[model samples]
Target: MRRLRMGMIGGGPGSFIGPVHRIAAELDREIELVAGAFSSNAGRSRAAGEQYRIDPSRAYADVAALIAGETARADGVDFVTIVSPNHHHLPAARAALAAGIPVLSDKPATATLAEAQELADVVRGAALPYALTYTYSGYPLVREARARIAAGALGTIRKVVVEYPQGWLAGEASGKQAEWRVDPARAGEGGCIGDIGVHALHLAEFVTGLRVTELLADLAAVVPGRALDDDCTVLLRFENGARGVLLTSQIEIGELNGLRIRAYGDRGGLVWKQEEPNSLTLYDLDGGCSMVRAGTALLGADAAARTRTPGGHPEGYLEAFANLYRDFAALLRGEPAPLLPGIEDGLRGMAFIATAVAASRDRAGWVPLSV
Candidate 1:
């Protein structure tokens, strides 16, 4: 199969997510970065292209020019990856799809709920392959957890608890990352919830294969002078008669990427932690507990397919991110790409953010999800 070419929008110098996207896309040797509008500034974009060794002609001034120039070229990119801020996600993806190129976008879909719905409509109408990078679901162990739950190893899930905490924004805003995240204009209605809470929400739903039917949220701006909520706690009711809790905060001092999930069922319970990505712990009802490590024979077919090394060889964030790219590339090659998060997941995330914000605003008891 031919190596797929990729173009990127955003992720220029000092940008947090752009290099991660580029690195993940290129990890498996299935895709190459052929072009990019790396930044809003034309000079930075060109400089980023030079740093990546891309041809100057392909490095356009902005997203519009990148889409136009690449589309006109015979060797244009096969797909476009949007790593821009949340506000740009909708427009960038729309432009790519309209130009007949597929899109792999960063999470939360759009800056607003209305835009997310419209984007969903456009993608469905276009009938193209559009994927959202819910990076946590790419882990081999996470896949193993999902497979086990689906097989009823954890029978009749009754409770779920997920949390994501970080201290990066605990103090006064000092960096570019903190600046946009705390600003409602760039990050949308949610601050911490939109940034990391969605990841926690998506992980819980992805593993249990259950939909959150309704939720009650208490969101707060913990830090002084912050415009958006830096702390959030949500109570969830699932379609399968399950109850859950979600906690996400950027002001938890000394905590760093502490994302974890636990699901309890009638028969057993399972626990997974993001910082310790290689292991999953399961506890049976009969006082029996076992730790399942990644790359082991216990993993199912989907998990084994995603595993890269033997058990005890640690694989963390970058590898997980790469798995999504690998699956998307396989999909573009017309092969089976099960478990890749697509437009529906993106839409669901946006809905969750919107609903949580509204629920918090009104102090409503439990708001049904309107996705």
Candidate 2:
């Protein structure tokens, strides 16, 4: 298959996610970064193009220029990747979709729920394949877990516990990344909740194939004078009467990307942790235990299809991210991308953020989480 050309919006100097997106998208040789509006600053965007070794003429000053220049060419970008901060996601995507290009964007969809809803309309109208990088859903073992739950390997899921804890924001916000994340205007209403909490929410729903119907939430800005919540605990009720607990915080000192999930059903329970991304553990009611490793025969077809290497060869964040890119590439080719997250997932995530924030702010007890 030919490489799908990709244009990037953001991920300039010192930007963490942009590099990841570039590297991941090109990993399988299915996508290539041909052009980008790497920064809002014209100089930086051009310099970034030079840094990436793409032709200087193709690097544009901003999204408008990128779209205009690229679309004018016969070999224009097949899709654009929006890796900018929360606020920029909507405008960039809107422009790309309007130009008749597909889009693969970073999660949360938009800065606010209203923006996400608007983007949804635009996506539907465009009739293009729009995907979100809900990266964890691409993990081989994560796919394995999802397949097992859906196949009734764990009979009648009763509970789900997903937690994502990071200690980077325990002190006063410092770096460029931290600055925008805590800013309400840039990152939206919920801080930790909108940031990492949405990932946990998506993972839980993706794995169990269950929707969060209602929730009672407690959100706090643990750092003094912070505008948005940095820590949160949400009590969830899934569509199938399964209870869930979602804990995500950026203020937990000593914690480093500790994302873990455990789900229990009548027959068994399964556990998977992001830090140890290779394996999944399952336990039965009578104390029988088994381990399912990535790239192993134990995994279902969905998981096996995603695994790239042998069982012992570890595949971490970038590979999992690349899976989404690969899937998006498949989607652009009119192939089925069953594991990919799209506009609906984006809506649910935005709703998760808006509803969780409102529930906590108003001290509302057990409010319905309408997506």
Candidate 3:
């Protein structure tokens, strides 16, 4: 099979997510990194291109130049990956889509809810394939959990608890990632809520297939001298009458990407953690418990299809992220791909961030989400 050519907007020197995106995109041998505007600085962009061994001519100064140069080529990139900070996601995506290129963007979709909606409208009219990298949804065990919940194994979902805590921003840290995330002008109205809480929110909705109808949130800047929130807690009311609690913190010491979710229903409950990832614990109403491991016969077709290793082996973050790229490549190849988070998910996530910010600011008890 011919690999689809890809261009990236960011992931310059010292960047975190760009390399991850590149690695994940190439993991299945279905996508190739052909071009990129890796950084804002022309020199740095060229340097990154040199590191990636991309043709010198394809290493443009910025995303606009990359889009122009790539689109003008007969062998232009088949798609564009927007790995820039929140502020750049909207423009890069808009340019790619307007140029008739497909887009795969990092999470939160855009800097704000309005931008996300605008992008969603453009995508809706374009009829082009666009996807959001809600990375956790790509996990095999996560799919297994979704399948179980959809199959009514967890009858009448009653409650959900999801938390994502990181210690990287525990103090006054200065770096590209930390700088943009804590700046409202760059990260939008939310900080921790937009960064990690959105992941928790998406995970809850993705696994349970329940939309958050209303939410009440409390956001705080835990670190001294920080402008944006470093910690937040949200109360969610699902459309199916289920209640949920979401907690996200970037200032929690010793917590390293501790994303965990648990859902309880009338018949049973399920728990999955990002740290372990390979196994899901299922609790019966009868007080019995069973552990469902990934790559096992017990997994559903969707989960099994995503699993690569056997029962005892492990698949992790990169693999889960690769699933999204792999599925997107399959779609571009005119093959049937499993459900991947699309423009709608992007809109919803942005809405969640916007509403949570509003709730926190206005002390709103329960704000109804309109996305």
Identify the leading candidate in terms of lDDT.
2
* Candidate 1 residue pairs in clash (backbone atoms < 3 Å): none
- lDDT of each residue in 239-346, candidate 1, tens digit only: 998999999998999999999999999999999999999999999999999999988898889888888899999998889999999999998888888799998898
How many pairs of residues collide in each model? 0, 0, 0
Instruction: Put down candidate 2 lDDT per residue, 111-176, tens digits, no spaces.
Output: 899999999999999999999999899999999899899899899999999999999999989888
Instruction: RMSD for all candidates, in order, please.
Output: 0.8, 0.7, 1.0
Clashes of 2: 0
For model 1, what is the alpha-carbon lDDT of residue 256?
A: 93
Q: Each candidate's TM vs. the true structure?
A: 0.99, 0.99, 0.98
Once fitted onto the true fold, the runs of candidate 3 whose alpha carbons sit more than 4 angstroms away are none
